[model samples]
Target: MKHSGKVPDFQDFVECVEKANSGKINTKVLSIGDLFAWKDCTSKQNLKCRGEVPYARDMVKLTAERGITYLLYSTKYDEPCSKVLNFLQAMLMKNFPLP
Candidate 1:
């Protein structure tokens, strides 16, 4: 499985998740990104952030393909961030209905 810290882009993120869903990753915890770094990167690369939803959908499909359970955990302290996370979670659930 491709390690998380090495994820330079969306493709890498998809690969790591796919590996985990496939049971090829034995690590108990996979560090995908630093929260602060992710926030900063998103701010600087706003255009690239447009792919977030598509990437998320890809992850959902891959996880479902392997019957792997997944969840989006948010630690945002503000109301707006919480709302955004909730919306994203809803969209994911809508796109990938539970069995």
Candidate 2:
């Protein structure tokens, strides 16, 4: 994602999951676009810019507690909070697989 500057086609992945389930299941994408927007807005206000300023960790924590699988398509891996976010679990370090 850092090298390509592109988000993956999340819809295609959802479709594949639906097909694999014989169209019996549906998937929801909790996009990080809104999170990025919030971070930008907070920056404009000169708020506290801690490593966890965007609080992606909080969202991930909720998902973990709820047993929800998180498939993140992030443009940043070298970010300050990347390590703190525990990327070792499901983080895809490679660029987004966009054709």
Candidate 3:
């Protein structure tokens, strides 16, 4: 009953994330660069960018306001991701109040 090619669904991914987060993914992240190349495991797709430093900073502030312990950012081939990680590690390691 299929006449045209169809794309795969991401239902499994959604389920996985929900389960992994234990139905509570309070911690969020702001990816400022390519964050999918690793998923692809190749350079066929381009996803490099720069802006994670400021992004992470903003995220930290937001998380504080929202009430979270930590933020996560898994990026690949992203200059911003590298820069932000370095900056976060070097500085901004203080207590943040939540709402």
Candidate 4:
């Protein structure tokens, strides 16, 4: 993966997973941050940024569709914890509704 100081496209993330599943690459860990780092709000001026929403939704959709296991790690200092949690909950409910 190219670490060109830019977040990779969602397709890049899928390719990485495919490679790892096929044993073509050694990906020890994958985080939600790695996929949405491009949308990070680096400045307090943009604290209300919701740029990662669409990406997060897509990630959930793709993972559910492919029956892939996903792990999410959040740091208390990254952003508002409630927002992250709420987003995750909504995504999970929408993609994997509980009967």
Candidate 5:
């Protein structure tokens, strides 16, 4: 998987999920983004930030690829999930309700 830091590229993630769904591989769980800690994207000093939101075009592609499900986990309302959602909404206004 192509990755920057610990976060894998969103397109790569979609591809792996598709592969697993097609029975090409047996993957039960796939994790993306940060699971250990949250980093602010607006901060210029957080060079170790792991919250790289998927690209707008990549997010659109993910929606088009059926059979993929995702869950959001967060401890705070104004956290990484919100940032991710905001980024997705800004990128894919028409495809907000990802199938």
Candidate 6:
């Protein structure tokens, strides 16, 4: 984000969600990337993400801040979103284990 001004990054996602949730309300969550993309993209893309922008981590961090858990991932594709969700969630969970 600092160097790559055009493309988005982790901080960018955080800022995007923060700006989107701009209000006095302390309880709000938003995510442009669903659970599938959130978890999958994190590893696939990581710091070298070079595809469409994502905001799943933004949503995760935002919700986590508010002590929210159990994020349900949805997909608009034909291949069951739950299947993708399972893989993606497992991928992310492996790296970032719950403390």
lDDT of 2 by residue, 1-99 (tens): 233345469765665666664578776777777445432212222223333444555333222322322323233544332222233222322332221
Q: lDDT per residue, candidate 3, 1-99, as tens digits?
A: 032234255554444555564578543443644454322122111123333234433442221223433344434333232222222221223553222
Q: Could you give me the TM-score of model 1 versus the true structure? A: 0.19
Question: Model 4 segments beyond 4 Å from truth?
Answer: 1-7, 23-99
lDDT of 5 by residue, 1-99 (tens): 333234367776656565553557754444554344433323232322446544445332222224322323343444443222232222234443421
lDDT of 1 by residue, 15-60 (tens): 6776776667654344666333342213224334545443353232
Please provide TM-scores, in order, for all candidate models, with all chains considered together.
0.19, 0.25, 0.17, 0.17, 0.17, 0.18
Stronger candidate by TM-score (2 vs 6): 2
In candidate 6, position 48 carries an lDDT of 36
Question: How well does candidate 3 score on lDDT at residue 64?
Answer: 22
User: Which one is best on lDDT?
Assistant: 4
Q: How well is each residue in 58-83 modelled by candidate 6, as lDDT tens digits?
A: 22321122232233333333333231
Q: After superposition, how far is residue 98 of candidate 3 from its true place, in Å?
A: 40
Q: Which candidate tops TM-score?
A: 2
- Root-mean-square deviation (CA) per prediction: 16.7, 16.9, 17.2, 15.6, 17.0, 15.9
Quantify all predictions' global Cα lDDT against the true fold: 0.40, 0.39, 0.35, 0.42, 0.39, 0.39
Off by over 4 Å in 1: 1-5, 23-99
Clashing pairs in 4: none
Count the clashes in each prediction.
0, 1, 0, 0, 0, 0
The sequence of per-residue lDDT tens digits that candidate 4 reaches over residues 76-98 is 44443223322333345446532
**What's model 2's TM-score?**
0.25
